[model samples]
Target: MSATPATPGTPDLPALPVLQADCSNCFALCCVALPFAKSSDFAVNKAAGTPCKNLQQDFRCGIHTRLRDKGFQGCTVFDCFGAGQQVSQVTFGGQDWRGHPGTAGAMYEVFPVMRQLHELLFYVSEALALPAAAPVHADLRRALAETTEWTAADADALTTLDVGALRGRINTLLLRASELARAKAPARKKNHRGADLMGARLAGADLRGAGFRGAYLIAADLSGADLRLADLIGADLRDTDLRGADLRDAIFLTQAQLNAARGDAKTKIPPTLARPAHWSA
Candidate 1:
């Protein structure tokens, strides 16, 4: 968890902004909608559409602070990308499934879909913010508008929506955005797309603008690595060491990804993200 040395008086850069989860505005849909197996990641076997054992009547996690301590590390790292609020507030009109038993089934089904759509929003928002993606700005804006509109639909409408098809189209556009961004650092080593880098010893590697899409970097040592503008879409970072790494402008990194990784005070992160509370100094 050591940081690379920086010159005195150097200032941190602005953090990249993206659609993020606001758990406070949510009704804890994740606790009810998703299932988990009893493994290292979770302490119990849970079924889909059923509430977890640790969920309180107030719709808050009873063990939120001690999730990892209690072997529910998966819960600690999961992010809904703002879907929980959209589902609880917008889609269902503040009507909780628990209050209306009939709505529980539909609510659970739509929650995952909304999570996926919100995830797309995260990417679109990121692409729109990238100056290098100006060539596709028009298309990105259009997609954002359309997706925003779709997210406003009610439960039945959401259930029938072809979210997978929509995701495909967005992925295509995002790939272009990534290409444009990575073009900034052409000399950097970046062709590790979808590689199994689990527990890889990549500490201090110069990974500027690298493509880490879908890479399994579980417990990988990334301390002091320069990860600026790196494409981190869908990268698994559970227990990864990121202390002192520069993740500024890294593409497609979610709060979930950051929460899952281990870092220290010296790790540079996007301005939009807060350092995980669990991180060691």
Candidate 2:
């Protein structure tokens, strides 16, 4: 997460200080709770509940700076969206698994649940920030409050939460928000929702106001494309070349998605998102 704070919020909507991952305040839950397969992105297979060998006693990655070079490129793309720290510090009261083995199982189970809730918080908070989405602001606020309440629930309630149903409800409001925001763009928007455009040669395409929601753009050559006002919620951007692409004001495009793709210094992104450090300068 960027050091810069999010935009100020109103009485109905609160600023999102906890939406960004703070690994230092976490107990390395992701390294242990999540399973990974041995692939081009990972050097070895890891099962759920097993700590990564690189996780230090202080809960820091031993090769944090060299993850990509060490064939752990998948780690670089993952952002828990503050779920790690929230579960470690707030949910478990800072009781680490090593220190309290009794809570380990429950803590691990709740971490992923909390992660989904935090992700929803991130999207709703971003939607609230958009001035054009004011028409649905009331619904967004209610969704935000309900989601926030869930994050504060106990381990049992969190683990059993019907997150899919909650996501379905929130997604409706998000779609409405996207429609309102995209209408402000001065271009004929293209709807590529859920389209499989993998490895497509689309460099320098005039994609302004395009709807890429849930689109599979893996390995697509989107360099120098105009994606302003594009709705990129849930888009698979792995290995997508976004070098010099203009994504300013792109709706629901998260930092995790930007981290998953390839880019350069010339890639224009939304102000709220930080430029990936791995991107060429």
**Candidate lDDT (C-alpha), each:** 0.85, 0.90
Kindly list the per-residue Cα lDDT of model 1 for residues 40-142, writing each as its tens digit.
8999999998899999988989999899999999998888888898898888888888788887899999999988888888788778777788788777767
Deviation from native of the Cα of residue 49 in model 1, angstroms: 1.0
- What does the lDDT read for residue 208 in candidate 2? 79
Q: What is the TM-score of each candidate against the true structure?
A: 0.91, 0.94
> Clash pairs of candidate 1?
15-271
**Window of ten residues with lowest summed lDDT in model 1:** 1-10
Which parts of model 2 have CA positions greater than 4 angstroms off?
1-9, 14-17
In terms of lDDT, the best-performing candidate is 2
In the range 1-281, model 2's lDDT, one tens digit per residue, is 22222353555456443988999899999999999999977899999999999999988999999999999999999999999999999899889999999999999899999999999999988887778888888788888888988888889899889999999999999999899889988889899999999999999998877899999999999999999989999999999999999998899999989999999999999988999998888
Per candidate, the number of residue pairs that clash is 1, 0
Candidate 1 has a TM-score of 0.91
